[model samples]
Target chain A: MEQAQADKNNSAIRPVLFCECLEKDGIVRRVAAALLGGYAFTWGFTALGTTCLVALGMGYAEAEVAMLLLAFLIFLIVFLWAFAAVRIDRVWKVLGGGAVLMTVMAWVMQHLLLH
Target chain B: MFNGFRIAMTWVHTWFGLVLGFVLMVCFFFGALSVFDREIDRWAIPETRFEPQPMPSFDRLLLPVLEQQLSPDEQEYAANMPKLHDAGKGPMTPRLELPVDEYWAYTTHRDPVLAAGGGFRVPHPKDPTLENHIHGRVTIDPRSGTVLRDDALKIGSDWFYPLHYKLQWEWKDLGYWIVGLAAFSMLAALVTGVIIHRKIFREFFTFRPWKQTQRSALDLHNMTGVVALPFHFFFSFTGLVIFASFFYFPLSHTLLKPLHDQHAVLEAQRAGLPYERAGVAVPMASVDAMVREAKRRWAARDMAGEVGFLTVTHVGDANSFVSIYRAGSDRVSLVGEGIHFKASTGEVQYEDPPRAAVSEINEFLTGLHLQHFEHWLLRWLYVLGGLLGAVCIATGFVFFVEKRKRQHAKMGGQGSRVVDALAVTTVTGMVIAAVGMLVANRLLPIDLPGKGDWEKWVFWAVWALTMAHAFWRSAPVAQGRLNPAWCEQCWALGVLAIAAVLLNWVTTGDHLIKTVFTDTYWAVAGVDLSLLGCALIAFWVGRKLMRPTTYEKNAVNRALALHE
Candidate 1:
């Protein structure tokens, strides 16, 4: 009976230890992704704002306003994406979408406005 | 009581530096370079004519010809160009005489009106539809509109201006704020470092190179930081102030502007203020006359050298004026008293001689920072001071990593890995980014669709790549030993520099030999050579560092023993 009890205790503790390891790893991954993602997103937002101003013939003041709005919009999108990526375990999808959207938007803005 | 305050300030100084030493080092290194930004730009963009030349009497040589060529309607339009100098009121823009295909560039004097009101100017088509003749540059012989050689001075200024701002962040107000914060942090670090050093005074005269690198680093750090403590503090603090508009104003806006109104107000402000055209039908005075007046004004001020700007204000109005400011003053280049003249009558209206005040203080600080005065001796001293600041920061960075490295090694696993990666990113990564962007500058076509802005993008892109690489590949210990990222970056720099030289030679048909001997040494050529120099330095450093070092072997052995 004692041997059986000991076996049950070990089984229960094993899952707890595994959970702890997962939690720590999850935290680290989340932090790293957020940092890197935030940085990339900031760049994308800035470029988008610049593009909007140039294309729209907006003045410097307007450009600044547009930049702020876009930055806020990007931050919201990123926050949501990160929440899903971290909380819901969709890291790859979030990172992939963020990268594509940022790069595409940046390139498109540059092309359309600059040209 | 003041002495007690002084004692306390000493303590404050010590702690501040220690806390922010590493970042300060970077700031100082970059700041030092920024001091010579114009010079660097001159060095970089070698082909652009940067220096001004005295024009022959335009009225005597080119005016009649231009008057004959210009249509009456075009002449009227040309008269709308802004005037040069003014009295206390404002400065004027120049009227372009386009008949000779030579633009009469006017000099503006120091006029209060120039700061407040419309400049005196006459507008014309900047582009004349003539290839290689569009510059509108003139020679002493007005008939010959020869293009002057690009001066070397402007390139240095161009390169160094951006360097001061730490081109890492997007070219926004925020980037400047970030730099300011970093500088403030450096100030903090400098203070803290002094506190941490128990033997600052004793160590001042002591530098033993044969001793441990750490000791030598510490000594150098203390010596530079301590000896130049006043300079470092003033510079860093003022730098913060200079960028205060970026940080303080924005934060204030955040607090003052309601969330919704901020965007609207900013937008409203972005719409540039309206400008009114001058309608008077009178002929303007000659630019040659203005130049002569400006020189006379400068002479009156006991100043020698050419005027920096000649300003004219209210071209057609009865109050229309011209102003001339002295340039190349040693102590305060920015603050000058100018002589203002009436545009219609060529009569002196008001005189503003230099006066000392808060604005003068500001100018003095800027003068100190810019070395506005052309005293080579003082300039060299400034350079030495700047280099010392760079050394202080570089050593601080090395020290930060070294300290962390010892601790990280004991911790083992990913903790050690992250630190190792950070070290590589901060030190080698920044250098790589700099060199990489430089290469991009030369390689990218000047008239490429987005080429004008590409240099900025290239810099940010390379930095981002390096940081990402550092973060990802750094976790594995063996990866640290390989330093693949570092090696890759070093190799990239070498390739980039080599490629730039080749590209320049191919495109310009002006290699080093032709540049130096045949076509006359160009300013852009200096940049290519500098790029080459950077590459050589990188290769040498990489080779030396990558080679097996006895010191590293011992360090490893020591680590193993400790683990045992």
Candidate 2:
């Protein structure tokens, strides 16, 4: 009788409910990933921009312009990532991860070129 | 025991914040802006937007002008100036030697004019028509005594710093003391808040935006305060220390028994440090040549600029010397040990102690306070820190109100009235004072009898009126049924006043557009834009509060059902 009741209950609920649940989970996952990506992008761009400017140090205006362009591009990517993260549910972890990754990237870039 | 103590401290924090929270908020906000006071001035005044002029070499024209202005007695007094052998004794004597040609030859003239201490100065022509009193450039050849660019007074950042700090009032040291007290209260409130918030860390990550009314306010209060806790602490502590000598340092009489210091010895040391001469002339070296010599001596150290002041001691005696310090370091301390020289022979006398021990400590403290480091990155960080401190104070005020509101709602009338009054001042009263000040700045008649003093009076008068209005309107505001329950009237007034300031500027023909595009595109435009931004924010807040809450809508439905 209990099993029969369970079957009835399952029948009463729409199959779309389960689908909706799955969709929500997928959205959250994507949002988390996007946030991480955005944070990494921002951190990497900031560090690179700082190091590049310092390294150039008025040696050539053209080099500064090029570095600035690259920095702006990174900033654009970071902004998109941040916007996505804010919109997505359960995505802060992604943002944190992204920041960490970007910091690592910046360190690598600084060592390779600036040093 | 601990729980009881926490509860008692919470009460203390609540009352303290309620009493001074709104004023503290304004102080912090203004103080933060003041950190960039110079930059603000640069942004505000349109006419003075240029890279700073290199310091004019003093000797080229001034000395020759001195030669012309001062009598032979003055010349003799200047020429025979004594070595500043002792720190306290005065200038030596003056003498004059005229050269027949470029040859190293001299004829001693014992003219009475040379004996009597009189020096020469080219009378700079004045332009009374200019608004800022900075007209007619004085161009001096750095190597010679010729005037270069003397123009109208560069009023740009000069007025801004004073306005922010003391509103250009110089009397009684009252403004400084008041600001100091406000800073102290702010520090007290910050400390009390930390003590009261038991689950600060746990709540740091919790921000439920969907919460209704009181719950939502609490959440916001916690979020902003917790996120910016470190920032709040740094600003409060550092702000207090910024004026530490003024507030806490012992008096000069008490510390330096000779000066009868009450506060501190250092305070006493500043008394009449710069003194004037007795007008007795002695033989003196050429100022222009001495400057060159000073520069050459410090060329290895790359002293960035000219000495700020040149003092002549014992005018006619052979013991006279000239001290040249780095310019613009006056904000740190007057006595900067850089390059000192014997004016007669151009010999190096004194250089500052190496950046070690006492000197390093002084430099570090002053540098941190003045933000003298060369990097813009550090300045941005400082600005961010100040903003966080403001956020902390603002949220704390809101939290205090929100906590009391629930219990106050249970009271019949008196309790609610008190809370309402506090709320009005904490929120709208501050906005009123700020907008009022700006309005006064523009509207106060510039030609009023004693215009400078009147301008200062207008600010205080407006601030006092704001407090009075808040007190009078408190009861009606409390009884008002608008959701979020704040009287949006004061905020509306603020918005109107801000618009008026812009209008006044336009009417006066100094509108931001003309001043920025046609004249100078410097930072003064930034100040106007910032004021406009504030107006927009105030309007937004007012509109938001006027909207009916979900709870209010539900209550209305219940009333309709009962009527039916």
Candidate 3:
């Protein structure tokens, strides 16, 4: 009976310890996602936005400036979303995946324009 | 991640604000001083204490100065010469023998001296298309064309102003990145703060200094944060925008370099300006006549102003042109109305048309933050806004520590103690360092070798000492008592501020009476008066801190009654 009681007590405490560790790790992941992922997404957005705008017959300088003006606002939004999102994986998918997709598209577009 | 959006937002606001609050404190405090950077420069360097002067006569005054062969800056030469010169092409050119490629001068409405520089071309460049020029710069008394000592640092502009944006950390632009991240965090904190602050309107007018420490700190934090919300948002936003192209998102010069170069060439072709030097030597036309014509044209456009910036590109070359830009002192924009003149013939090549809508917006955003326009009242308002930002951040630190110190003490955590020490160091310690630098400036001999460098050392040394003192006294904070360092440093700041003013009087012999009334030199007088004001406030705060808190006083009374 004492052995069973000890096992039960250990089981109860183990999950609590696990939950606390998970919570700390979650916070670290969220902060990293917010800053580093947010920066990547914003960089991609600026590149693609400027390139697309330039291809759409806007002046290069004006397009660059307009995109830069909007970049920080976009970064702020994504940064907040990174923390507020229910699923960390989804945040990463959106930020990291979106960054890659947009960056590739921007590169292709710039290549076409130069050609 | 939290129970609700509000809670989540609060978490974000509290943590991010706490983490970046230290950096934000420096940014806001130095940013406020940068408002009157030129005035402070006048106070530091008494030799430049005269009134603001317009651009000197270029033909007579600036020409002779520019004509003199000048050696490149030693630091720049050492850093750039190897990369710029190709040893395989031939022998390296001596620093003084480099050909002058460009001449430029810049001044603002608040400047008493003109800053002029020359870019000398490096021979045998590894990359022909790249700009391979070593630069030399000098500050001159525009009225007499006398060069000021190059070693004398413009403490305000060179020190405090850059400290706000870059923290004076130039190692691979580490400071820029740190400040940029801090600025972004500022935007996040502002947004999160709004979401968590449900009764912002109600808290705008609330301040209960008599309450407990945490409550009063939060009250002041909310009040100052709310009061300067717009100022805080816009300044941070514009600061990011100003450095966007150069530091934050350098797409134009990097990923878009090809397109950018193409556009530049096409634009030059359309504007009938030369994109490259002709290599053929030619006697330059009179720049004074070009300035005259430019002034006449500006007057015709009903925006007559002094020349704020003038540049001669491709100097001594056939395709060289002179660009004269009108000072935007009367408006909220930077120097504009640029008129290009052919250097060989002195005829107008192209007068710049009005800016497009996007360009105008860009310039306005940059200009407002830069504050080149002459508006005394607006300038003070900017200073007040900056101080409110500093106060908001400082109070945030206080509330963070006060809310956590007791709990952390119970838990045997040193988190609150460490934070409180840093808070004291940044708040009182920062002011002490700045004033200490000023006192050292006045106390140091005028002709001392590397006087400016010594002043900088004093600033860093004083700040480090204060940090040491704060950390040493932080032991009491772990026990849930106030760190006496805060009150002690406040007193030190008060003393240092007064000593700085008095030392200025002794060294420069320009006391309040002579500066404020006899001669009416507002620059020095204004700085002196502001220092006195700072000292008065510091003393008042120190005295208040010396008094027992209401909690302590009540405890003492209850103990006495129980004994009786």
To one decimal place, how large is model 3's interface RMSD in Å?
5.5
lDDT of 2 by residue, B429-542 (tens): 644655555555456554445443453455467657656665665554344332233436546654755775575476455567765788753345555666676677777777
For model 2 the TM-score comes to: 0.58
**What is the lDDT for A41 in model 2?**
51
- Expressed as tens digits, the lDDT of each residue in B4-115 for candidate 3 is 6765677778777877888999999999999999999999999998989999988899978987835588889989999989999999998888899999999988999988
Per-residue accuracy of model 1 over B1-564 as CA lDDT, tens digit each: 112323323333332333344345446555665554443443334343234233335456445533343222333334332221222343332334322211333322211011011211323323322121212221122224332222212223334455566544554566666565566555555555565566888978887654445556667878887888778766765665454424532422332223224444554344321123335544557656766876776666676556554544443444445566555444444654666666666766666634434345655665666555556466556656766776676565444444334334445525435544554565566656666665665676655664535666676788778778877765544332434555666766677777777776776566888766776554445556766886897688667556655556767787799799
Give the per-residue Cα lDDT of candidate 3 at A97. Answer: 94
lDDT of 3 at B268: 76
Q: Regarding DockQ, does 1 or 2 come out ahead? A: 1
Task: Give candidate 1's TM-score.
Answer: 0.58
- Using TM-score as the measure, the top candidate is 3
* Candidate of highest lDDT: 3
Lowest summed lDDT window (length 10), candidate 2 chain A:
A13-22
